[model samples]
Target: MPINSSLASLSDMAFGTAFVIYLLAMILSVVFYVKAAGEKPEGAQKFIGMTQSLVWLGIIVHLVSVVTRGLATHRFPFGNLYEYIAMITLFAMVVAAIFMQRREFKPLWPWVLVPVLSLLFLGGKNLYADAAPVVPALQSAWLPIHVSVVASGASIGLISGVASLLYLLRRWQPEGKEKGFFGKLAKPLPGAKRLDLVAYRTAIITVPVFGLGIILGAIWAESAWGRPWNWDPKETFSLITWFLYAAYLHARATSGWQNTKAAWINIVALAAMTFNLFFINLVTSGLHSYAGLN
Candidate 1:
């Protein structure tokens, strides 16, 4: 089916609106951080409420953009890097919305918004593509299943990564005393133990879904290319990242490697996944290269 140019334009406009709303949300969150400093939790309820509202509004708009793009193209929207980034960021925003509803997790919105905005800018400026049907190789029943699972897992992995980074910073700071810039920044975040737990839970969800996505990719490859594995660059990096996450889980459960060590591993896994998403997809030639910037 041909692309619906009208709906395509509407999706683009909605995406732009989502970006603006998210930017506003990030600003409000930062303002909340500043005003809430040295104030009781009860004193800062208004900022939290406003930020959370913007976040939810952004999520709704972002979902409309993704859904309308799919409707316009008559295929899953995440067939290329541009659409994939949008879908992944949408998931990230939804997760952030859920977390921000809790008082303890309210401070995390700005942290999450930075990366989401960065990715959206990257997608809009460098990776934007017109809504259209995917290539023949991507026209399969597994496309939506495989890509959606992978994107969702990746979004959760990002959350886990942010939590680990916050955990490390919080752990490094002296108790009840702010030393410098990093210390003051980490001060508003949840306690290190809570951050570590958040990291662990998010990682647990990421690894299995990510692994399942890989297996589904293999199945799709077998049906499409008449082979189960081709050692594509994306495939290799994805496997490596998966192994890193698995190691993170192992270390988390181990005696000596439970907290700080496992947190470091989780951050590394997130880095690896980010590398695969950009470097392997954009800088390297592979069977998946077609999905790169156009």
Candidate 2:
């Protein structure tokens, strides 16, 4: 079937609207974080309800945007980088929403929102593609399964990475005083121990999910390319990402590496993931370069 141009336009409009809402939520969350770090804890608490409502609203609109795009294209919505980012941000927002409701994790809301907003902006400005059928390479049944699982893992990895980064910042603070820019940022977030735990627990989930995604991708690759592992840029970076996360988990559970070392490892894995998304997909020519960005 041909693309439903009407629905496609609606989806774009909804996506823009959702982006605005999420941007507002991020701004408010930042305000809350700032106020909480200062002398006005009560003022910070006031923004909590409003920010929460905006997040829920954004998630609903984001879901509509994804669904309408799928309807318009008559296939999975992640046939291109633009749609893939949409789906990834949608899942990230849902996970961030759940975390924001937890007392210990609420203060980290803005950190998570920054990456999501950045990706949304990049998608809208640089990677926007027309509603069309999936490419021949991605027309198989595995597209939905493999892409969705990988996107889901990436979403969770965002949260996990932010937590680990904050853990380092918190640990670096002086014994009694928050002295620097990073210190102030970390001071508003949960304590170092809690942040470490959050990173570890989330990594516990991220490793397996990400590994499974790689396996599924390999299976799909075998069907489409007559080989399971062709060492494509995306595939190679994905393997590196998987190994880094696995190492982070192992370090987290070990005796001497549980805190700073594990946190560093998780942060490195996230960097690898981001590199794969942008540098590998957008810059390198490979089997997975059909990002619709050119």
Candidate No. with top lDDT? 2
RMSD of each: 1.4, 1.3
Worst 10 residues of 2 by lDDT: 174-183
- What Cα-based lDDT does every candidate model obtain? 0.88, 0.89
Give per-residue CA lDDT, model 1, range 1-294, as digits (tens). Answer: 888999999999999999999999899999888766554645566887899999899999999999999999988897899999999999988876775577888888888999999999999889998887888888899999999998988999999999998888889984477677776777778788888888889889999999999999999999989998999999999999999998998999898765898899999999999999889988999888866456
Model 1 is weakest, by summed lDDT over 10 consecutive residues, at 35-44
Clashes of 1: 0
TM-score of 1: 0.96
Question: Model 2: per-residue lDDT, tens digit, 74-187?
Answer: 899989999999998998889878866887678887888888999999999899999999878889899999999999999889889988998888888732478777667666
lDDT of 2: 0.89
